[model samples]
Target chain A: MIRKLCIIGVGLIGGSAARRARRFCEEIVGIDADPENLRRAETLGVIDQGCASLERGVAAADFVLIATPVGAIEPLFRALAPLWRPDCIYTDVGSTKGNVVEAALRVFGIVPPNFIPGHPIAGAERSGVEAADARLFEGKRVILTPLPESAPDALARVEAFWMHLGARVERMDVGHHDEVLAATSHLPHVLAFTLARMLGRKDEQAEIFRYAAGGFRDFTRIASSDPKMWLDICRANRGPLLELLGEYETALREVAGLVRSDDADGLYACFSEARAAREKFLKSTENNHA
Target chain B: MIRKLCIIGVGLIGGSAARRARRFCEEIVGIDADPENLRRAETLGVIDQGCASLERGVAAADFVLIATPVGAIEPLFRALAPLWRPDCIYTDVGSTKGNVVEAALRVFGIVPPNFIPGHPIAGAERSGVEAADARLFEGKRVILTPLPESAPDALARVEAFWMHLGARVERMDVGHHDEVLAATSHLPHVLAFTLARMLGRKDEQAEIFRYAAGGFRDFTRIASSDPKMWLDICRANRGPLLELLGEYETALREVAGLVRSDDADGLYACFSEARAAREKFLKSTENNHA
Candidate 1:
């Protein structure tokens, strides 16, 4: 029963929200700095109208989704703090929560009640509005890291909005959210990027990639994610990411030590343990997904 | 035509070869220490007959495929060397070639002229003969690393045999093959295992995994690979794998430094380079696959 929904960014994540919210919201307004993206979102019927400026587009909206990159969230929030209606419920879909919450604190001296920091655990290697899918959030988890000032009604509204888009809603404190994602998502991304860049810089890269099996392909699949966005994410979540990297390097060093010492038993144990752990995770994920 | 194709350790790789070669070879004889695997393979029609004894199964075969773990290749080759006719061509599909070739040289005091070391660059997370697929090698690359003493006809026969099974064939020296695979395959497996194990061992692992998205899933996909088989490959290719892991750690350290120093440009460069490289690889892979 929302009167108007304003989605900032209008790229894959934002456009997808617009697509899914089209049926529920009375009107969906898309805002983006890039005219082509806005035009594409409008043409694809992902939104009812496109706005070049956030202030103008969000003027009448009761629900606002800030689907910008993690770095842009703070600046956008600051810009809209005065303009946003008190009655409007605000949320975001940035991967990193700590930075977004800190940004709010820095800009406003206190977090806004209407602002609920969220991250939709959904995406693909593709980018832009052209890659938008209405069902992108279907069965996906949408995490919210709400501040102390966040009102219950606002939080409830945001949660309901995500759930209506077919997402499972989760709430966590900013620190815990950052730590959890640092190990599971951010660190994996770092490894994938490093592995891909290392191989790409090699003289025998083409030959190496040609010979790479499905395992290698899958192992580095996330390396193909949008670089600008990933770069923003890496920078925004640097602290937690650094800590996770330390853990990963420690684990890797242990593995190398086992290999160097020719500890076949140790290596076998490590591999078997990892295989078992991954198999269990995969099973759980499948069950949850089903 | 190979009158009788004797495959030692008839698991995924061997059973797959057997399944595809049934039309090309007059008989496919499977050998394994695990009687249950042999029984399953026989029941699955992946093999014509199960050979309990290596001495008897390969005794009269025209072509012998030693498809055991890389560690077992030497002893099997040694056992077969003394018993087989000089006319019988020998080859193996071990992941590590240097160890396999070195084993032959160590056992016979000379490289076997009939033996051509090869590795089919194809696999699944699942292992065993029951998981074998006839199309596993289709559109896949199979690398052959032949010794100086290897007969030209033996090499040609191995190439033709793989080609007939729908694989594109390439030839490289044992050192190069090991180095390439170490970088592209072994190192990735190590990272996947390390990340998965590290996350799995954490107290909050369930929560971490529950929130993990597709990127995390795909990045650690190979962590589910067969532990024993991967352990064997890791041990056999330890030299090259250790070197590659060192390179990977160095790259990771460099990335960490960029993050610690807040070098946004450096981080962007690293991520963008990786993204571009992976995109290029994905494009080429898709084109070739198409």
Candidate 2:
């Protein structure tokens, strides 16, 4: 029944969602704050129509997807709420759910029972619509955090929407989604960035980079992510992110102790166990479509 | 003047080195502990000839390269000492230089003037001769640690040998080499393995893996590395490895504090700084050519 979709902040996530949703719906419009982004999305045919301003573009769409940085989602939703059709559904493609959900609840006050929160767990080092592809979400897991008071019909429709785009959808409480993602996604990225920063602080940064082999390059590649965007993620998922970081540091210290003591056997055990676990994770995930 | 070369251990590194060294030398023979590996190298035409026995392989060769695991290098070098031609040059391809240097010196009262301790900074997650490619070393850095008493003539010959194989060789003291590599290569691998292990310890590893994005996959890809190989590396470089682990933990703890404090300003500063550093590192290393 949700045939027309308008996607806000048409960057990588928004553009990708628009492209993937094209197969399930007949129409898609994209809006972006940046004129260049709107122009690129239009040329790429990522959307049937594109607008530099959100208000002019998304006023009549059946569904509006807010896919911006963590800090911008609430403001975006509030701006679009006035134009939203009475029965039309609303959703998001944000990395942190709790903050965005709270922001939405604070701004919209339960008038729209059709609002659904979702996150498609798929992305690349690259960003923007220029880097977006329709197949980005195919075989990827998409987590939805619908409020308990959300209309069941609205949740089902949103779930069906993502499923049609080839994403396997799972629903969980928003708080739980924030905690799980904080551990698996946000914390790792923060650690990577921090490690890279420490190395770069040295006067011999050029030497360090020159000497970086495959391992160093891959380990810190995520460190090169967009600054403002990652800042937004860290701030939004602060509580759980801090908890996970403590756990990681504890494990690191334990390994460090074994190394300090010249406990070759202990170091070997830790490395072996870690390597085996990673192999198992990769093998188990191989069957996933994405 | 060095023409005939012999490489022990016909795995990825040995096979690739044989092919690359073949370009500079007229003939190269490879020896492997496993008959299957020797046979595969011969069948792949990676070597002019394959020797099932090391004694027969190094007896006639002017340059011998022990390209085995860190622990295996000492035993192989010791066994070859009896059969070693008086003026023959010897070298090794091990991850840890200090330990290998110590082992070699332990075997020979004085460090062999012709013994070159080297590690080529090139490899992939995949192993075995089948994965070897002739251009593997092209544009990659190769570090060499020559003892203070090492013969200049011997050092020159070894440097020329790797240069001919398309690596840009850099010289560093053994201790510094271990310290730098412990941070650039070893610690990152340890963290990767640990991350994977943490997930494996979880009750729903399958669920965790199902949602793993590209970030986790790439970050932990090296965790799929051979366990015995990593174990040897950890044991051999315990001192520097412990120091690097401590530094990494300290960095992680700082990020955790920012997260726990929910300080958006602090988080942004951290992310922005890291992002700039990573970009700078990448830009500087762009023209490394090795």
Identify the leading candidate in terms of DockQ: 1
Tens-digit lDDT track of model 2 for A112-224: 57888899998876889988888888889999988877889888888988887789999888887887787678877987888788777752543666777777777788887
Q: What's model 2's lDDT at B99? A: 94
Pairs clashing within candidate 1: none
Q: Write the per-residue lDDT of candidate 1 for residues B1-290, one digit (tens) a residue.
A: 78999999898899999989998899999999899999999999999999788888987898988889777877776777768677888888998899888888788888878888899988888888888989989988899998778899999999999999999888998999999899888899899999888888872434678788888888888888888888888989999999999999999999999989989899999999998878767766776576
Interface root-mean-square deviation of model 2 in angstroms is: 1.6
The local distance difference test score of model 2 is 0.81
Cα lDDT over the full model 1: 0.87
Off by over 4 Å in 2: A1-3, A22-27, A39-45, A48-56, A80-84, A109-112, A203-206, B1-3, B23-27, B39-44, B48-53, B203-206
Q: How would the docking of model 2 be graded?
A: medium
Model 2, range B119-235, lDDT digits (tens) per residue? Answer: 998888788999888899888889999998888887888888888888899998899888878877888888887777776676253256666788877778888887678878887
Residue A242 error, candidate 2, Å: 1.6
State in Å the error of residue B52, model 2.
5.2
